[model samples]
Target: MRPKIYLFGDSITEESFGDGGWGSSLAHHFARTVDVVLRGYSGYNTRWAVKVAERVFGAAEGGGGGVNNEEPLVVTVFFGANDACLPNRCSAFQHVPLDEYKRNLRSIVSFLKKRWPTTRILLITPPPIDEDGRLRHPYIENPSNEPERTNEAAGAYAKACVKLAGECGIPVIDLWTKMQQFPDWKNACLRDGLHLTRSGNEIVFEEVVKKLAEEGFSPETLPVDLPLITEIDPRDPLKSFQQ
Candidate 1:
């Protein structure tokens, strides 16, 4: 039987299976060794992800009593994105506050460990934002719809998460740094400079695969050609030009 991997994350993971997020791409990458079960939601924070553990993995929710005896081999927990973002939809500039963000991430990891005692956890950081402080838009023509949120601050948040994950003895994927090295990362996001493009999703998928391999996860066969959302043309108005 293929090992089951329970994925807990935010929008980037959420978009994978639906319209082309890294989560969906991951399904293909792990097809040879593990079955992917995505439990990601848009706009959900680490705090909220902990809630899913109670809601879906709890006995009252029709899950295994307190332990996940069913699938115990693998599980990935990713949530800092929304947690580091503004609390409500009302303000785009507001954030969850750095200190609180750390606490929430700790809670999320602890909760998963308590439930899935033997599961392997992989914590992923959100991607980097464009350095110019300007975001690209797909449908909208102006930046009025989206407010400036600090990508620089995200590095600190990611490090905090990495530190916490270390306490839990889990591996982490530094997506922020990887995206920064990409020549087109700045111009690869959708209308907003936050989300990733199909190519971006591919980059994420590759990184995860490489990390999993480094962590000693060797699958007999890996799936490579999973369809993704439509690709955006660089010259298109919806696409941003970094150079």
Candidate 2:
């Protein structure tokens, strides 16, 4: 059996766009040769994930715990998408201020670490946007709720996450920078400049694999049932699509 890694997060983590989510891509990348658990919820923020964790990892087997006493579990927390939705969720960046967002993120990590002291924790920064990324919806008269999906405010949130992870002694995958490097990357990666697309999911998978390798995690030790996807969309001319 391979080590069990649990992913907890919102739509981007859940791969709601078919196989366009990072979690799905990650599962495909490792599932063919390792063990992976894809547990992602749509339209949920970091706050919601707490509820899921409480149910699965609150106590031990004798008391509704997340541990099975038979497998090594690794938990990865990816959030802050919906929280950053803005406008509708809040009054344009009022809901999850950088400080509050950081606080919540830190709280989640601290809780999980305390619960599973031996588990590996990975903190992923939310992806970028096209124009109006901050404004969530229900737009009324917010100047920031136009077509500009690229939320400059998101950078603050991402930086806070990195800083927090560093303080907590955990690893972070900088998806923000990776996405920027791709050509016309926004189109292939995200459906609405906010959500991820099939190609975007591939980028995440690639990054996760690289991170695991950089951390000295040997692929051989992973389970055989891990999802290993071979190809993506071939119709697109990009080499990203495999066989």
Candidate 3:
């Protein structure tokens, strides 16, 4: 069976397989070596993710949980954008208390580790939001004309994610911090002050690849899923085919 890489999280992840998305870039990179499985639920926070974690990663009665009785090669936990929603400013439906957010993230990592001990987990902090961009888009209702989420609030969650990953001994991509390093990040990386633009996706894809390489999941190290053309014998094609 082919190896698998799982991407799990909220809308950012949900849209990760779309055109010019990070997930798609990874899929292309790992072609013939593994499959990239996307389990993104739009608007979901860690709280919601924990509820469905088992269904997605748990072992089946007669079958192995992940690919080929081995845990998925990698599982990315990306969230916090929605959870960082300013409670008083945004709808309560999406706002998760900071403490609760941390708890939920820990629970998610622990649960996955318990079920798939060999799987590598990478946590991704939410990217920064542009208040001006948000105001222009107005995706959320705000009578006070305030953005539902702010860079400052999301930065807190990002810090929490980094801390959690350190405690758990896992890798983390602190997008919130990294994205802003670029000039004009608001327009360069984000589309609507929330979702990622092509540049944002590029950064995410690069970071993920770097982490995978560090963890020995690089295509150079992994066995290709199919036989190479060079492996087939030119003099005895039938025998090579059978072999």
lDDT (Cα atoms) of all candidates against the true structure: 0.66, 0.66, 0.89
> How does residue 26 of candidate 1 score in lDDT?
72
Clashing pairs in 1: 15-21, 16-21, 136-191, 137-191, 138-191
Off by over 4 Å in 2: 56-58, 65-73, 87-94, 132-150, 223-243
lDDT of 3: 0.89
lDDT tens digits, residue span 26-77, model 1: 7766665567877767777665565566765655334753434564466676
lDDT of candidate 2 over 59-83, digit per residue (tens) = 6443665545443456778887666
> What TM-score quantifies how close candidate 1 is to the native fold?
0.75
Worst 10 residues of 2 by lDDT: 132-141
Residue 118, model 1, lDDT: 72
lDDT score, residue 58, model 2? 43
Output the number of the lDDT-best candidate.
3
TM-score of 3: 0.93
For model 3, residues 1-243, the per-residue Cα lDDT tens digits are 888999999999999999999999999999989899998999888888888776666554424343334568889999899999888885558999999999999999998787679999999999998988888887666788878889999999999999999999999999999999999999999999889999999999999999899999988898987578888778876776565
TM-score of 2: 0.75
Cα distance off (Å), candidate 1, residue 41: 0.6
